[model samples]
Target: MFFSAESGQINHANGTQYFRGLEVKEFSEETATGMMDSLLYAPCDYVITQSYTCMSREEAKKAIKRTRRLLMSADDDAVSQRLDLDVALDLLTSGKIAYGKHHFSIMVYSPSLESLVADTNEISNALNNIGITPVPAEISLSAAYMAQLPGNYNLRPRKGELSSQNFVELAALHNFYPGKRDKAPGGCDGFTAHPVRRWLLYQPA
Candidate 1:
């Protein structure tokens, strides 16, 4: 009933190196709740959701410049040496570039306090594995959950400073593209994080 982690859709057996998505030792009872999102409201005993929002161009530019200036004047010599900041600054100064920041929020819900706590802890740890620090939505839990819905972008609880490039890398958007490229000699077909398992295959009783 479980997927075999070893078999992946990406067939880069030699040259390509795939980014390690997550490194959790085990899945939770609530693991299925977070991964699947549906348009219809099929209320469950628990719900855990997260959202990432892209900032406006003007706001992002100003924020980027302000952060750069602060780093430029800071006494720490290492802050300016960070490659992420340099790339962001170059995008702004080099010429016209599409760049922005993203605000994000995560919410975990359960009918009982115990499951809620466990699910939140599991999800938070998973997020941390991929370099995201989950901050509890103190006074903004409702807003954070609501923000997961479409047209509720304004409900994001915190101002996310993550760059657009970083967001793209984190999201599945940059994973792999399909087209004539797939038809090309070395190109791959659309891939999935989950691949079929022998245990799940049909067998005669």
Candidate 2:
């Protein structure tokens, strides 16, 4: 796998590639060559290369289930709510939840709409305490969205699949070129070309 800092893309010869703790798609030979040419003409601060083992679909599903189980077990009324809030704060401070580069959305799954409505203020305050004052419009909790949450957790590389060097290089790059807190969604910020699955556990905030 070859990651280009200039493009923020993870390119691979074939199959899938893992970079920065995420799984990105493979690039065609022609496209990969063109990317290389572009990088040569406009050099970037760093280029990362690595070898990794990807997780199969069953393995990925099992991992997601395990994560969900852990989150559910940890969530126990106010105690778990406070813990989740603290985790979000810690992630923000550690640069894991950068504004535009990587942002977290709270997804609440309740048995009924009334339950969600009742917990709205509690959720809002938790985010507010961490300096992330989201507008009412940004919060959404529905059976439809909740049903799809498990799918969103799929396709991530298994833990320890990536090398230590990959983490080091990614941390260095983020330090030098930390993404802005923009919400427009375009360019490399979206990372649409080489989509990668994120590892954040999506539990109610």
Candidate 3:
């Protein structure tokens, strides 16, 4: 048995299991590559990397390009409503996308609609630019949890025109939006992409 997070391995043979804490984390990338490479020479009947695939590399690229055009031209109102989508996509390209045996969840916390929408395209473009094909199904935390868990969240517009300030307020709840108190000159004065997730444990009624 092996634990990826800590990179520990357990060896069991001869009716006994030996436990050892090897310096596996430092060698994880190389070890993983070596193991997978061995599969090229001989097939092994085992699972690898928990297996996450959303769309083919080609599909993700197409989806991202289409979405990016929409973002650059979308109205402030539309941007405010769809930002969570963008963050989720960015995470996918960052290799943060995860899936289970059956269901998949795209997790982002407190995302403004605009950032979510825009960042998704950015992530898609980033992935395509890097040549890693990802197939990710999309899900929104707010829509999924609103009825069960809504909070005192509100947005305020900066300059009363651009949606930047409004989007920042919406994103803070998720820890993805950076504070507007200070920013670099000539840099985007609005929110940037940060992605997060929350876990819910519901009791049966």
Task: State which candidate has the highest lDDT.
Answer: 1
Instruction: Give the TM-score ranking, best first.
Output: 1, 2, 3
Best of the two (1, 3) by lDDT? 1
The alpha-carbon deviation from the true structure for residue 24 of candidate 1, after best TM-score superposition, in angstroms, is 19
Residue-level lDDT for 30 in candidate 2: 17
Model 3 regions lying over 4 Å from their true place: 1-53, 74-76, 98-205
In order of lDDT, best first, we have 1, 2, 3
User: For residues 30-112, could you state the per-residue lDDT of candidate 3 as single tens digits?
Assistant: 11112223222211111111112245434554555566667767743566434644654565456655221111112221123
Candidate 1: residue pairs that collide: none
**TM-score, cand. 1:** 0.53
Candidate 1 per-residue C-alpha lDDT over 149-168 given as tens digits, one digit per residue, 9 for 90 to 100: 78887776655465544444
User: TM-scores of all models?
Assistant: 0.53, 0.22, 0.20
Residues 80-188, candidate 2, lDDT per residue (tens digit)?
Answer: 5345445544554564532111112333323333554444444544434433343432212221122234554322221232222233332232212234444534433
TM-score of 3: 0.20
- TM value for model 2: 0.22
Tell me the whole-model lDDT of each prediction, alpha carbons only.
Answer: 0.45, 0.32, 0.30
